[model samples]
Target chain A: MKLKIKDVEFKNPVLTASGTFGYGNELEDIIPVNELGGIVTKGISLKPRMGNPPPRLAETPCGLLNSIGLENIGLEKFVKEKWPEIKKIGPEIVVNIFGEKIEEYVEIAKTLEKEGIRCIELNLSCPNVEKGGLEFGRSERVVRNLVEKVRENFNGVIFVKLSPNFTDIVKISKAAEKGGADVLTLINTIMGMSIDAENMSFKIPRKVAGLSGPAIRPIALYIVYRVYQEVDIPIAGVGGINDIKSALEFHLAGSTLIQIGTALFIDPWIPFKIIKGIEEFLNKKNMEFKSIIGYLNKKRG
Target chain B: MRFLEEKSEIINLIDLGKDYYQIVISAPEISKLARPGQFVNIKVTGSLFPLLRRPFSIWSAKENYIEVLCKEVGIGTKILREKKFGKISLIGPLGKPFPEPSPEDIVVLLGGGTGIAPLSFYAERITENKKIFFAGFKHLPSPYLLRRLEEVCETLIIATEDGSMGFKGLLSELIEKEFKNIESEYTKYFVCGPYPMLKVFEKILPEQRTFVSLEGIMACGFGICMGCAVKKKGENRYLRTCTDGTLFSLKDIEI
Candidate 1:
């Protein structure tokens, strides 16, 4: 099950998505962290953010709407506290870095590089934050410029996590690749809103939030399939993956690696269950893991 | 810090009427370790209609069964109420427990509606401190819970808005009325209730002596989701209700 994206090696293709799995140490009481291919830390910025007020989460059908505002311990605390603990968890730790300014992104990258982090997932598509997240990715020029500067600062693997929100996703995918991304993590939460009928106020006080779960699976799949056809970099598929079938759907749609997100809330053991399911699936079909990736597009072509 | 996803059997589900139901499930390990004020996140059905698990304070736990009392307020609780048989997933014994009172101190347990759940568990477990419970509700509780609470506390006062039960006024009014005689530094108060009821207690109870249990809207009842944040008193940073507390001293929080 060994795989490589740039110089970083993965034991498997099942990683826990950022924000979904906190610090990778939260569920040690339930599941072993080493079983995962990697754990993506919550979005860390240059300064600590208190996040949004109460009523941050609202349930929508088979999905969830959240406006967490990217609350984190910031860079200094993450490296001093979280990094040491997460690094001890054994899986490849992919630090998800966020910045309000383009220069902030480069600066955080420089710190992680100095700290000897092997890979980083750039968070350019966090819908909950007021600035520097989705706003930075909303422009092709900004996405390209941001990633290019980050490339200069961090010498290790870089994954540009793109959003499924507004603007041209394919163009932005190309912009990330052109700017020297090692991998493209496809699809952050799509923007959504929920209204409490009786209360007559927004369920998530911000009036807008990011939606994840099986509800956004199709949207994520389309984005992955579309981007896989256009970009040369590997696609790390996420968004609403709850089961083995959905996991493989992303794999067939051209995701080289798949991330378990909102579904982990449903069951913490899901990622491990999926890892076992996929390995079993490949053996029963006698198919190579690489051959199955992008199988739909490959067959059609 | 240790909790597991247990497939607990539905020992029984009883409709207490008035849209409230009592569910008893078997989770021996979680039940034995569960303390007062600890809660569980229940995935009520196998289907996906109600996506996230609902958090319920342990109404009571004994032997192999953990029971929770809930109202059919929304989709998740309604699904839980409608469950006829079989097992539902439960992740439990979560959050910090209500602090135990010193033997010399007198314990005052205050609750409203389903907020009585954890306090019932608390009063049942106390063998040292003298326990007094003040419960208020819009309607009278099911006779089973009413009787159980009566037995657990040395003194129990019941109040309903419509005067259908014991006292004819609010529990706050009853407590304030009663405490005029017993108010002392030796009294340690623990409150569990809806936001409005908690707000009323926050005003009447001494902040330094009161501990309030808060049940905020939650996605994951564990710390992972970062969804259950309650603002800390006089601080810019927020505390995670899932890990930091389902219980906090009244002086330590905004509400």
Candidate 2:
């Protein structure tokens, strides 16, 4: 079954998250990316980011911690070199934009609008870096103001991705909705740190990092549920969702769509598998997925 | 891109001294397309940790099968070693292939430990040319691959630091000794090993005729992450080892 958000209509509801899918061309040799719902590219900024130093990643109990610091080649290089190949993948190419200032976001969004991107996932919640990520995301006023500024310049489906570290996610999501965001992507990585006890040192290059994968599923689902109750906009649920069961949890929690992130490191074919599984699950139960979007929340006592 | 659905089955597993093992997988589609010095990124079945694919150089490719030699160093290889027959997943013959040696060229192939995998593949392909192999290991003798090297090359020289195998010295020393014995000039040298060993070869060999395969911590294996970059010599730019090379001329890379 198809799902429509604003002007874009996805063939299904399974899409790859930003920074996990790597522009969609890297996995071409092994898997077919066109079979999935869509692909959200790695975060693009005004200038190229070299990212963090070596030891940028560490494996935790059941998840991964990354301080990648948004390593990308800037919007100019992306539009010139990466876009032509990405367009051929035959899925909606949603560009994830990150910026240090309000104007930077508006400028990038306006550029992307002219470039014909199907949607724009505003990255206001990345927790890996020292500046411009959680700093802007943590404040409800700043999040609303930035969303309003981008909405003023660009006319596209604005999906505001929210951070999980906030004390009240419902407040921040309400702020985004008031500022004219079309959809909300619940729960970016939670701020977490790991220490090397023997050497009394930080395990990663940056002492503190953002945690992802199965470890963040509980928190992600909680935020998705809370935001679902407060916001009227469609939600694109992400974080720690690796299988059809986890995906179904998001759908039942009132998320209109789902994005696969940390699971991409484990299995690039997971998004495709989850898409197939959802279809089969719907067929077997003889029910349409769209009818059950928020069915679990409705039965809650 | 054409996706080949050939399932690769484990044909044989042999421990080759220390923690290393030679795993031979039979995939006709991959073997038929695989060339020397190419690598395959393997996804270990049923592994929850180290949830990324591991890249291994193709040791040998024959009729309908290809072999990958790996050491149980981390969680990925540990799970791979425990896998029995009838397990199957994705197989890719990726990256650039090794350069072919000219008929008149005398090749000196140097390798250390598991790095000898691609060298053996190169030795097997250039059967008509004069080839000399210098292999190095830690303490124990690598009988599994040593025997295989002897069958393909004109001469095979072994070196161990603990005097456990052929020559009681390093492989670099053996290369120096062999260099003095050969009166005819060798056309090219192919070296693949640890960074330190590669650094040593980069210092001694002539830049114009030497090629080295570099090893870097790779994530996507297809030049996206920009993790496997080697600085170009005399320039500030870097080339991706996954796309530009796992093999590059010695002069092209800084170190």
Candidate 3:
């Protein structure tokens, strides 16, 4: 079950995706989060965000569309308040940082480095926000430049989370690797909107929100499959992973690690289920854990 | 802040007519700790189309079981309304409960649609108090639910928008009229209904004493999603309905 990327040895290759898990303290009583490889905190900005207005979430078939707008307590409060509780949890805590400005991202990274944080996941793919996020993710130059700037400020492992919205995902993945990212979190929620026919308006007031769940699983897996072959850095697959079968598909498609997002709303215990099932499958097949990752890539026609 | 995710067994699903139902489930742990105003998020027994769990107010909680007043409004309830027997996943007793009423003060409960759920739960708990439970509907709800509700309240008032049954007026009108007949100085109001109903009371009801439960477009039913947002009355910020409240004071929030 041990998966090591550089000096960081994760207990399992399973992590809770950013923005879904709060500050990793919301479900302490309900789920065995310590058993997870890492807990990704909500995206923290330089200042506290009140988030988007109400009617922020809507359910469409097997997925959810959210315009949460990356709501979080600012970096100052995160380190002063949330970090104390999150650090006590057994799994590695990855502080997911977001910023509207490149300078803000550099400042946050420098602050986290000084605070002795082990890892930080850069959220360049959030579709709900106006300034940073998807704008930064779409341009290959911006992705590489921002990662490089943060890499200089922070000595810990840096994970760059990218989106599959419009631009070439392969181009972006290669850019993150070239910019000194330790790992690449493949595919944030795809940008989407649903219309309420009765009201003759958009389901989400933001007009466009991030689409996540099983609906986007195939997209995420394909993105990971494509990006894995293009970059040398490990790919942390995210988007629509819910159960063991879905989790394993990512590994075969070439995800070194996978994050559970929208399904956390459906079932909190899914991570545990996937973690145990992966170990069982590995033992049954008599295969090394690492051998299964991208194993299907070679077989695909 | 703490809750249990119990695999509750479905004891029965009784149709109360007029699109209302009483779903009784076996959940000992949840039943033991649950109070009025708190809710449980339940996933339908054998379906997945309605991916998110539906949140229901605790209509009743007895020795080893709990009930929710289910109204067939969407795909989630349409499937849930027909589920007679099996196991379903339940996560509760969530959110803050209504502040406890002192025996000396009078309690008023105003409800309409499925908002009658938590008020019904509260009515049973505070049966010993001098309470007035006003159950409003566009037409009459089933006699079973009405009769059961009447038996629990010290004084029960049934109001309908249409003249099908009881006082032919909105519950807000009924409450306003009742205030003239009954003393208003010491009455503490607990209202749960649609926004139009709640907003009307925010004007007529005493802000300091009135507590209203607001519903949100929920996903997790817990605090993770940050989806269920309610604006604070005078502040430029938001509060999560799951964590901060599904229950709030009339004076503290804007609708």
Candidate 3 has a TM-score of 0.96
**DockQ of predicted candidate 1:** 0.85
The docking category that best describes candidate 3 is medium
lDDT, each prediction: 0.88, 0.79, 0.87
lDDT of 3 by residue, B26-138 (tens): 99999999998999999885444778898988988899999888888888888887777877999899898877888787888889888988988888888557888888998
> In model 2, which residue pairs have backbone atoms overlapping below 3 Å?
none
> Clashing residue pairs, candidate 1?
A213-A240
Residue A30, candidate 2: alpha-carbon lDDT? 72
Question: Largest TM-score belongs to which candidate?
Answer: 1
Which is better, 1 or 2, measured by lDDT? 1
User: Against the true structure, what is each candidate's TM-score?
Assistant: 0.97, 0.88, 0.96
Worst 10 residues of 1 chain A by lDDT: A125-134
Q: Which residue runs of candidate 3 sit more than 4 Å off their true CA positions?
A: A126-134, A298-301, B45-47
Model 2 scores a TM of 0.88
Where is model 3 chain B poorest over a 10-residue stretch in terms of lDDT? B43-52
Sorted by lDDT (best first), the order is 1, 3, 2
iRMSD for each candidate structure, in the order shown? 0.9, 3.9, 1.1
Model 3 collision count: 0
Rate residue B32 of model 3 by lDDT. Answer: 95
